[model samples]
Target: MTRRSTGATTMPPAPTIPKIPPAEVLGRLAALQTLPTPALKEMWRQLFGREPLIFNRPYLQSRLAYRIQELAYGGLKPETRARLEALGEQLDGGNVVLRRIRADSRPLPGTRLVREYDGIQHVVTVRADDFEFEGRPYRSLSAIARHITGTRWNGWTFFGLKGRPEA
Candidate 1:
């Protein structure tokens, strides 16, 4: 395209990577699994420019294979990475510690939990940070379960939010 100000023509940017042969990529991927631990670690250092943190054989192999393919082909798009980061933030509220933990099974606020105990129905309303059972606030479902059954129980299992443990 020609620039109006400078009256000079310029070419568009070239592709970041050249297309690689499928067979070459496949051969490199297949070779990763057969490599010894030392060779794999060396390849990891060469590809990633850093020492492998985990040092697990399978992890090294898989990551090496992925790096090979990524170099041959391409990596994730910027938009995809941004979307993944946004999703992680939403799931953990940007808390690093919470991100490593499993997501809790708390129902959305205003959800009504219904359970029948001794032929009488019980209802618990889920709030943002607490629960309401019989118009009274409860810190945990287990507390409400203990109040009903007079015994300690897993709140999630008691209210059927989670599966019961097998004997």
Candidate 2:
């Protein structure tokens, strides 16, 4: 410490942080199990060019490392992204109303639902617009279930297509 012109004690400015190469940063990120939260946040800012929405340690480290490697190497192509999105949409039934209404019980066409009741096997094939059972076309599975069980039953539940009744 030294005396300033005003006769007050002063200290030198903090040293600047050196910029590390992306490759080195990636290597460190790979090797380190944990990093300081502040450092991780800073890396997130540098790699993403924006502040992260999450501050969880593992999430921050993983996302920061991925961004660093992605920048140093390359990111997914537009075609790949589009393909992934299409696949997601297909899994989602390609429509919000269908997804919400059908839930997990909507099997793709050509799928088969097999069940055994009273020592007899039952097979139901999913069709594009209807279902096929015993060489006959049926519109609703509930009708098939009612015919088979001789009582009212939820077709999806009877065929194990649904886990629980929808609210």
Candidate 3:
């Protein structure tokens, strides 16, 4: 075709959408699923104040869920991350994690604490002499601390409020 005096342009063809390999898709799902659902759910609640679930109303919720999950799994938050570091100083080789608030306040079952350290937050639950959620075994809080942070804690406690530790 010959060039015209007008500045009109032709539209480009639509971009093709590539299908994801089933193996790759399954691999990612497996990794995410490796972590306990309760822990993942707790992380979601702390970060987004909601459960880690794929919403399917209009498909928008699933998108949000993926974003939330991505943030939680990336790394610890700066606020809580520092706290975890400070716990080491106070405990002198003891693990000091930020404990969650309360049982009912907990986001899910089998979740003990949602502590923040070093600008990062973690949702953890431990039953004495048993293994932690991710297979980290602990005989005591100190052991749990070591297993979780590889250090000590000076300001570690269970989740509670001003009037209730068991609340």
Candidate 4:
């Protein structure tokens, strides 16, 4: 009986990144800020392993350059990172905060919200701290909605201010 052995192959070692001079690093970072939005986004993906949440060109460029510098010069100290995390948690309630649906939905003061319900046209004037409907000040749009419909309703929904809920 005879036995045969397969040959073993050696893999090449990973390439090493040369230490760039500080001046060159600064120059590179400066150059990054002039890149277009799409290019910056590509760089962001390469550096961060994910797409950027912001689409603004200047902001993207700045953040990507900062990230590049951070990687080369080392990141924040553990204590600084922990402090930042704690601050972020406090601001964000320890979870991902959803964008407000009504962030820009509210009408400016003196602007009017009009709705035709039950063959009657209702007009609501946006005020500094409250809404005015029929010369009556109301704290909430829901209150106005209740006044109009005699039932509990989301004022924004009733006035066609809110978009359809995502399924």
Candidate 5:
């Protein structure tokens, strides 16, 4: 009898590459927004193999992260890693989510509007309880900002941590 034959052909899956840390991913999201053309996104896919994770979109955060792991970070340049780390601080400042462990509400607990006051970017911090600017009564900085600038900015405006003026 002829030798028994079994037909089977298979190729191995691609090697599992490391995931791009979420912080770096956020930095990429922020950096891509700075670009003006689609070319940047194309370059990103070619370099990193997927799109960046940006919130406020139709998809859930979990799904976005899963996709990032499934597709991105295969052949990314090591140089881009450092650049993204720096960018994360700039874009994702809201990453400062910690339990309440503070003594004084330094600079008051409110939004700090970055405005050009006296030819300089002066930070105006406000609190909801007793917010006043030059004898003008306002509820929050958001109110004053809207009154003066006529636009809404991100509400989570923070100057720095408690007692860290230089920060």
Candidate 6:
């Protein structure tokens, strides 16, 4: 019996990143400012492994500079990330636009929130994406709160998920 080989396929090697000494990291960061926009974008692609959300040079340079240092050192700690999220929420003031932009702080589905307004008890059931109030679907707790109180409100505070922002 005889066998014939058609072809052999091989994957390309992954790009190897050269190690930069911690002290040289500062120089590398400074050099980023001198590179052209296209070069900077290519560097961003190489470092981040994805296209930047924004094409602004200053934004790219700042992020790339941080990434360079982060690679040599380390990124933010878990506690730092948590603290930033908390601060973001605090500053967000339950603004719907800001809420949509930042992290999702919604509670788990199947949770029930009870609040009394005008001497009547209101119940809201949390869903995966939206909420159910008075047997109707609502997009945000603020919307439900408005329906109940006839005024604007921060949904998280309204549901006791978060306390009212300090004045």
Can you give the lDDT of residue 139 in candidate 2?
A: 86
lDDT (tens digit, per residue) of candidate 4 on 1-167: 88676777677755443444555677778878677778788777777767789898878877867777776787799999999778766644566442132233556568898999999999999876789999889988889999989999988888887864311
Candidate 5 has an lDDT of 0.48
- Model 4 has an lDDT value of 0.75
In candidate 6 the C-alpha lDDT for residue 113 amounts to 92
Cα-based lDDT at residue 66, candidate 5: 44
Runs off by more than 4 Å, candidate 5: 1-106, 109-114, 117-128, 158-167
RMSD of each: 11.2, 11.3, 19.6, 10.4, 13.7, 11.1
For all predicted structures, in order, the TM-scores are 0.51, 0.46, 0.24, 0.41, 0.24, 0.45
lDDT of 3 by residue, 95-133 (tens): 333233322222333547666656667555744334253
Residues 18-122 of candidate 1: C-alpha lDDT, one tens digit per residue: 344666898888888788899998887777767789889989988888888888778899999999989889867888666654345566668888888899899
lDDT of 6 by residue, 95-120 (tens): 75766544456665698999998999
- Decreasing TM-score order of the candidates: 1, 2, 6, 4, 5, 3
**Candidate 1: residue 130 lDDT (0-100):** 89
For this target, which candidate reaches the highest lDDT against the unseen true structure?
A: 6
lDDT of 2: 0.76
Please write out the lDDT profile of model 5 over residues 1-167, one tens digit for every residue: 79765877686864453556755776655555455445454444454446644433333334444445444544455788778766655544535331112212324346554666336454655554545555576655556556555677432342223233221
Worst 10 residues of 2 by lDDT: 14-23
Q: Model 6 segments beyond 4 Å from truth? A: 1-20, 93-96, 99-167
Question: Can you tell me which runs of candidate 3 are displaced by over 4 Å?
Answer: 1-111, 128-133, 154-167
* Segments in model 4 whose C-alpha atoms lie over 4 Å from true places: 1-51, 54-105, 163-167
lDDT of each: 0.79, 0.76, 0.47, 0.75, 0.48, 0.81
Q: How far off is model 6, as Cα RMSD?
A: 11.1
